[model samples]
Target: MVAWLGSYGTSYFGEKAYPKPGAVIMQYTGLSEVTKHEPPTYECVGTRDGIASYHSVRSYIRKIKKNGTDAEIQIFDGLTHGFGLGEGTVAEGWINEAVRFWERQVK
Candidate 1:
């Protein structure tokens, strides 16, 4: 599953209903109170994101990791919310990193 912004929330909310996904890649998502499932997850967010707090993402990832799930996260400096693929910003190579993370999950 690949989700951005608001859709990330949907993924978190629906985790219980669906079979565990192979992996999840989320960007710029807010905090959720839902239970964390064991799945490899890769998440990224800009430090300057206004819509979704970077701290929230960090906390969520930490919680997932504590549950013994493989979780990875990246925080790009001076970036804002909704910077998909990070475009020409400092986060430009994020998509490649995400792909690599997904590949690791498959292995």
Candidate 2:
């Protein structure tokens, strides 16, 4: 599985050099044309994110789901970008959710 944040996440999904991951957990990232790299992808973004628009993440999720892949997304209201593990934000517990999503792929 691949767990990435910010531009790193976009690069992992967009670039072909990296080996294809079994699943992806993307956090606060913009959309990359990743139709070719469809995997069980889990995405999270804050609605108030300025760096990476929440709409981009939603669009990416829609595209992946359209390709018949298992895609899950969580949009946290009133939160911004780069809050790793959501810390004290309303998005707390997102890591646990991502872990569960990854575990489902293994099964």
Candidate 3:
């Protein structure tokens, strides 16, 4: 099973790619158009993100779950875009969770 992890525009590509993935991990983007056979997804976003609204991401996750897809989202407090790995920030360690989510699918 294939899996993907990306941010912003790349995340959209991961979502729309052919054949889909076993799981998807995205950050700080709010594209909400869900497909019929979406894979399980793990997402993270900052509540204070200027580029992407956490609200939109939350709404997207709801749609994902409603479509019978497993989805999880983390809305970090007081952070913004381009905070890679979120080192020393509230969003730190998010990648570990995303990886665990992916591992579950591939197993």
lDDT of each: 0.77, 0.78, 0.76
Highest lDDT: give the candidate number.
2
Candidate 2, residues 1-107, lDDT tens digits: the string is 23342214445566545545668887876665664447788999999999888998888788878888888999999888888888888999999999999999888
lDDT of candidate model 3 versus the reference? 0.76
- Model 3, residue 97: displacement in angstroms? 0.5
Error of 2 at 60 (Å): 0.6
**TM-score (C-alpha) between model 3 and the true structure:** 0.79
TM-scores vs. true structure, each candidate: 0.79, 0.79, 0.79
| Alpha-carbon deviation at 41 in model 2, angstroms | 0.7
lDDT of 1 by residue, 1-107 (tens): 23322224444665444445577888987854425544677889999999888998888788878888788999999999989987789999999999998898888
Descending-TM-score candidate ranking: 1, 3, 2
